[model samples]
Target: MDKPEKGNPADVQMSDPGKKSGKQPVTACLICAAFFGALGSSFIYGYNLSVVNAPALYIKAFYNKTWTERYGQPIAAETTTLLWSITVSIFAIGGLLGALCVPIIIKVLGRKGTLLLNNIFAIIAALLLSLGETAKSFEMLIIGRLIIGVDSGIALSALPMYLGEITPRHIRGSIGQFNSILICLGVFTGQVLGLPELLGQESRWIHLFSFLAVPAVLQLCVLPFLPESPRYLLMERRDEAAAEKAFQRFLGKKDVSQELEEVHAEARAQDNLQAASVLQLLKSPAVRWQLITIIVVMACYQLCGLNAIWYYTNGILSEAGFASNIIPYITLSTGAIETLAAIISGLVIERIGRKPLLIFGFAAMAFFFSLLTVFLNIQDTVSWMPYLSYVCILAVIASFCSGPGGIPFVLTGELFEQSYRPAAFMIAGTVNWLSNFAVGLLFPFIQVS
Candidate 1:
């Protein structure tokens, strides 16, 4: 690897770390870009995640209807279980494929271009799902889910990388958390939309799947107008002039010399190394801890049983003797708690630092889980025990969204420089989706067993 060109104006390193250039106000354009990009990508991911929960019964009914119409007989329970499991778990399989594709796709298309192209997956998924019932094909729903899973996998990797590169470092954690916040918002929106009076009806369930296209279309229209990442242009593509213009546009100011210099120094730091292949990345001593941190964080992300809790919270509520009709309202509260936690986390993350939040949040989750166990075990003995179980559930959601739920994505971007980030994300994303797949496929069986 050759040294970064040193004679350019971008090469002048600043002398004092504390004497940082004052940050310009975050511009409307930057917010719009991040917002729409997240809406099309992360929001769709959250929507798909919880939206399926609301319509599970309706969709299972449709599946039975389709199987009977096609085979001239009602579907057996065993086969129905298998088909539903496949439909849910295949999304993670597609996500794994998408994560594997990230390095090549981003390298070829650039960050903004890849996000624009990712919307194609969302659109195609919406179309397939919208038409699945009209065509009477449960297979179409399964295939559509697989496609959107790919879309989510790409977004999970791309959006954080894109957000980190574009935003100023001092505020990166705050803004990066917007990815998780939007995900909570998407889940809330999906839950509200999937209510009985809304789109979760037997005849209207297809529309719930189709609604994801609205944001995808909005992103497609608006994203092209936003600038590509300045760091990506300067560090990866070596386009100094273009990177300068992008920085100016992002900051809404002409004087981007200091920022450009910082970017140049980072690029020069990586000049000795080639872009790492997956095998080489795993073997490299220099990035060993960074890679381990990412893998561990992702493992915690799924294996913490947060998704499993979300999948069964309503069932838990019902078993605790809550009415079936109020489950949607209670589920809505979970999303609200998560959204509030994400908002508070965003506000304080920079001040508290990432490690403390991760430690505290995980610790809090364990405590809550313990309390939940006690409450669950004693619910029949105490009148207030069920309410305590409910509080424990909310506390778990709050603890999670405050740290473990969102920080891993932020960490994945922060741990690596430009050189190793894409590959690192690929590995982390594969871990994440595979873990999600495991939960989706096995949780019901685990509960039964």
Candidate 2:
């Protein structure tokens, strides 16, 4: 690696103990970028997932009232069910559309730029949802859901890419976990706000969607001051001066010659390659196994039944013989457990490595899920069995967040080289949202069966 010229502005190295430990210090700027970035992006995605649940009856009632006013008759039960299902499941469809747009959008906008523009979807969706009641239009609410889905799709891909690129290799896993942690926090926030005493009531439910603007606006204000991805600037834009400034800002040090050289080396190695398209990525034999691994992992990330838990928290508790009034409070615990587990995972992922945590999480989930089934079946025979089922639910959530909830995102970024990353994420996001759509559309029917 060639060192920067002695008089270069970014050539001054700060005194840091991590130099001796073969690690880099986590900087304030790096932390802010990750926190605010995920706050607006992945947080909204997770919030939307759980936010609809507590307001389900209220939303359905609004649907009915709108139908009655428009048609001079009440909606049929089957049609009501169908409309609600579409409202819940259409997010995935929008996400699929957004995922398809990743390659071109990121190429043009850059990772941070893509995220900034994505807030447009969130803000528009917020307005549509919050004002749908006053407008007397159910379609506005559905459209809003779809638009926000697009926002989430783009954010999911871009935020991980940005986080992965900005952080040093030593702390990459820890920083990447921010995406998952904020998601868990978002789920918990939705649950908290959805309480009847809060925004979950018929009159207050519209406010839930309105809250989306807060983080979006916050990110818009905070993120512009932060640096763009050093790798993106160096590799894609070939703007060495700007990349050096970005590297210095993110690393919180003046001497970034080694970091610059690493990216320069990668760029030289891929000098023959252009940013790949989805078709090209699919056809390339070199990345065949990498593509397969990402696809399988992303598919399982959605298909692993975690969403089912979020979608059916109330029903699950009710089935376990819990009183209706207490189930909402109990539901909050699941989100809390999820957030805690993800935090713990972030702390230890670099030390323990990704594969072990993933294997352990999946195995533990299987065990607890089976135990939950047994307890659910036997709850009627014993007074204590329902509590056991509750414990099992918590265990399953903890198991999931410990590894499987977050590692897939980290792996998607890690598995591919710079040129392939955008296309790779696009493919992974496609599988993810498709599987998510399948689960959201089919899970109710499957549960009934």
Candidate 3:
């Protein structure tokens, strides 16, 4: 195909009066596609992250109640602690398992298919959680969390891949950042719903766990109407007609020839190439640097103590001298700050580039964590110390949202060519979940020590 002339219809269609060159204008279809895609996927991952935190005491009591009922004796504190740890950590373990399955699922089902099928995990998780209390089975809640973890794991990998495949090249970064926005929304929504007036109660706390299904059901209902990725249709399936239709629907315009041609050229270049597996990726020298970069960045994203702070924010705040009743409100405020920072980062990240935000975010987090430590140690001695600790924690949260929190998902799509991307996400997702599991499982022991 020849390039469109300067005044050609294709050229005119591609450029808006105020739009940047090579960038697609934001359309209603794109917004709906992105919102529904992330709503049931990455959003759930964020929701689940903070949801369990508010109901910790109630859930622990339920665990003990079920254990004692089953064994005809009161559950020991150590046993309850062990059981609770398993409950919290199993989600990440399940996430690791989900990440491991990405290559096969995406290859066989395609990106959209994988997401559609993945909704089953969410439904199952919700059912198990809603029934856990009624059945007097603590194991049900554990299993439900694990299933939701698997759902989240697949979403973390697949949603970004789908978003990347479907969006235009120039706007991809901004659109991709929307995943983090949805996750922020999910976390904030979870925190709000977990408040005492909602489902965060001694007797009604089970609703918080069951509410995971709402987004999944919405996604399941709406997904059939959205287009499958044009890139996936063209590159993987070699279905040009379908890919053209997909591009048209996604762009909300008829002239998708330029965009379609770009995807076609990329697909043609890799005509006979096969996707690399996880082991193959590690052993291949050609892509070793790319693989290592993703691994290191993903490790930093998870192991930077963000999850530890999030999972146990109340405890951290209590130690910082915040009263118990106000901790929920403070936790809600952090989510708002995170979402706002991510929005600002999305606006600027494309202009300033990813590396700078990442650097500033990580450096700022380190500085604030150190300050937080000092504040915690001397809060009783200094009248203004507790306020300093609050500022430090909020700053850490803001720094994370600005760069490290969302940049990695964007980078996974950017750093690798199409053929190597699945394998990269597979390895990176596994490392991320494993690191998360380590934090969730071991943080309690670390705190105890």
Candidate 4:
């Protein structure tokens, strides 16, 4: 590992308190890039996670109806369960595939280009899913889920890289939280729209998937006007002038000489190393601990059981002794709490820093998860126990969003230099999607047992 040069602008800005006061303001272009980028990216991932929950029964019914028309017999219970599992789990499979593609895609397209291109998957997925009922093909819905998962897989990697590179280091963590915040917002939006008064009805469930197109279209319209990542330009393309212009737009400043010099110093430090492949990244001792940290954090991010909550909110509420009629409304609270907690985390992350928040969040989650288990086990004996169980669930959600929900993505970008970043995110995305697949596929069985 090469040490930063003495008085390197990047190192000075990071180490010196006085220099922090001179950090550039967050520009409108930067905000739009982060907002619209996430709108088209992680938002779709979160929406798809929860949207299917409200429409699960309807989608299953559609599956059965399609099977019966073709086979002259209704789908078997076992078969329906299997198909539903595939429908839910296949997203992770697609995500895994997308993660595998990230290194190549990001290298070729750059972060912004990759995000813009990813919207095609979202648009196509929306079409397949929204029109699945009209087409009388449940397979289309399954395929759509897979495609949108690819969109998420790519977005999760590319969006973070773009945001991390574009922002001044002073506000990087806060800007990175856009990914987590929009995801919560997406989950909340899905929950709100999935209500019976909206599109949750059997007749209207198709419209839930149609809503995927709105964010994709919004990003398509807005993101083109924004700049590509300055770090990517300067480090990879060696286009100093273009990188300077991008920094100016993102930082809302005319003089980006310090920023340019920082990237130049980093580029010189790397000695013109090419963007590394996943295999090369893994083989290098330089990033061993960084890679390990990413793997563990990302695995924990998915396997800590948040997706299980999002995927089966209704079922979890039912098990907590909530009435079937009230479960949907109760589920909405989880999304709301998650969004609120993530917003708060974004506000304080730079001040509080990442490690403390992560430790506190995970510790609080463990406590709440244990408490919720006790409350659920005794809910039948006491009227208030179920409400306590609900509170526990909300607490777990808050704990997660407070840190673990967002910081891993930020860390993935922070830990690696430009050469290793794409590969680093690819590895993180792989663990993330694989763990997501395990939860989506196995959680129902776990809950049953």
Q: TM-scores of all models? A: 0.94, 0.94, 0.94, 0.96
In terms of TM-score, the best-performing candidate is 4
Residues 106-200 of candidate 3: C-alpha lDDT, one tens digit per residue: 99998988899999999999999889999988889999999999999999999999988787655777888888888888888888988988888
Cα lDDT of model 2 by residue, 123-189, tens digit: 9999999999999999999999999999999999999999998987767789999999999999999
Give Cα-based local distance difference scores for all models.
Answer: 0.85, 0.88, 0.85, 0.89
Q: Which structure among the candidates has the greatest lDDT? A: 4
lDDT of 1 by residue, 163-235 (tens): 9888876677888998999988988888888888899788788899989899899999999989999988988
Error of 1 at 409 (Å): 0.9
The 10-residue segment of model 3 with minimum total lDDT is 2-11
Summarize candidate 4's per-residue lDDT along 1-449 as a digit string, tens digits: 64432322354445343375245567889888999999999999889889999988898999999999999999998798889888998999989988889889888888899999999999999999999899999889999999999999999999998998888777888999999999999999999999999999998999999999999999999998899998889878878888989988988878878778788877887776877888988988777888888899999999999899999898888888889998889999999999999999999998999999999999999999999888888899998788999999999999999999999999998888887888889999999999999999988778877
Task: Note the residue pairs that clash in candidate 3.
Answer: none
Lowest-sum lDDT 10-residue window in model 4: 2-11
TM-score of 3: 0.94
Candidate 1 has its poorest 10 consecutive residues by lDDT at 2-11
- Cα error, candidate 4, residue 350 (Å): 0.6
